[model samples]
Target: MPQLTLYGYYKSSCTTRLRIALALKKIEYTTVFIDFFNKEHRGAAYAAINPNMSLPTLAADEGDGQGPVYITQSVAALEYLEEAFPDNGVHLLPNNAADRARVRSLVEVVVADLQPRQAAQTLEKLGNDFNANQDQKVKWAYDWCIKELQAYETLVTATGLAGKYSVGDTLTLADVCLVPGIQNAVERWGVDLDKDFPALAKIYENLKAVPEVQGAHWSQQPDAPKE
Candidate 1:
C-alpha cells in the first residue's frame, strides 16, 4: 500500500469531491491545502506540482522503488482511485456495457453543463468578470443548473436510485460527481433543493445519511447562509 497525499483547496468543489471519495475508500492521506480564493494556486510552488495550476493533485509514495504518481484533474484522479483500490468490488463504472454508458451519460450532463455554470457564478463573486453582477449571475446559473437537475431527476428516478445509491443501488463515480454538485447548488449557490429538485433532493439526502458521508469530515466549521 502506498501513502497518498492530496493537494487541494477547502472550498473547491473538485477537491471536496476527491475528499469524499478518499474517505469512502478509507484511504489514508495528508491534505496540503492551497487557497484558491487568494490565488495561491497561481504561485510558483503549485505551478511546479501541476502546470495547469489546478487543485486536487494526487501523489502515491511508498518506501520502495515506487516513486510518486501525480494526477491533476478530478475525474481522472477518481478513475485512478477506483481502478487501484476497489472495495466491495463495486466499480464506479458498471460491469455491463449498457449500464456504463448510462452512468457516463448522466454524469456528462452535469460535468458539461452544471458545474461550469456554477463556476461562472463563483468567479463573479470573486469579481473575475467585473461586468457580471453576482446576484444576476448566480440566479442565471441556478436556473440552468435546476433545468439540468430536473432532467437528472428523470434519469435517476427511472434508473432505480431509490434502492441505495446513484446507479444500481450502489455507489459509483456517478455518486462522486453528484454529491459535490449538490453541495455547490445548496451551500455555495444558495439553491433550495427541496423546492427546486425533489428527486435529487432525495439523492442528496440519501448520500448525506450514508455511513461514509456521515462520518466523513466536511469543512471543520460548516456555515449556513446568513439571513
Candidate 2:
C-alpha cells in the first residue's frame, strides 16, 4: 500500500473532488493545507511539487524503493485513485464501458468545462488584465457555471442514467465532481438550484446525505473558517 499525501486548499472545488474520492475509497492520507488566499500556491516550493501550481496534488509513496508519484489535476487524481485501489472500497467507475463513458462525461462538465473558467488564477487575471471588478468576476464565474450545469442536467435527463446519484444508483466519480461544483454554484454564486436545475437540485440533495461527500465538503475541511 502506498502512503498518500494530499496537498489542497479548503475552498477549492477541485480539491474537494479528490477529498470526496479519498473518503469514498476509505483511503488514509495526510493533508498538507495550501493557503490559496495568501498566494502560497504560487511560491517556489509548491511550484516544484506541482508546476501547474494548482490545488489537490496527490503524492503517493509505494515504499518499494521507488520515487514518490505526484499527480496533478483533479480528474487525473480521481482516475488514479480508482485504478490504484480498485478494491479499497466502493468502485467509482462502472463495470461496463458505456456507463464509464457516461460517468466521465458528467465529470468533464465540471472539471474541464466549468472549473478552469472560475479558477482563482483566471479570476485574478480577469481583474489584472481585463479590469473586471469583484462583482464582475463573480458574475463571470456564475454564468459559466450555470451554463455547464444546465448542460449536465440535460445530459442526466436525456440519457436517463441518473438515479439517486449522478449516474444510475451507484455513486460514481460524476457525483464526486458534482458536489463541489454545486456547492460553489449555490453557496457562492447564489444559484437557485431548485428553480434553475431541478434534476441537478434533486441529485445534489441526495449527494449531500452521503457520509463521504459530507465529510469532504469545504466546510468540513480542517482549514475551513470557524463559524
User: Highest TM-score: which candidate?
Assistant: 2
Top model number, lDDT: 2
In the range 30-73, model 2's lDDT, one tens digit per residue, is 99999999999999999998999989899999998887799988
lDDT value for model 2: 0.91
Quality of model 1 by C-alpha lDDT? 0.74
Lowest summed lDDT across 10 adjacent residues in model 1 is found at: 217-226
Q: Go through the candidates in order and give each one's C-alpha lDDT.
A: 0.74, 0.91
136-189, model 1: which lDDT tens digit per residue?
777777787778778788787876654466676777777877887887777767
How close is every model to the real structure, measured as TM-score? 0.84, 0.98
Instruction: Provide backbone clash counts, one per model.
Output: 0, 0
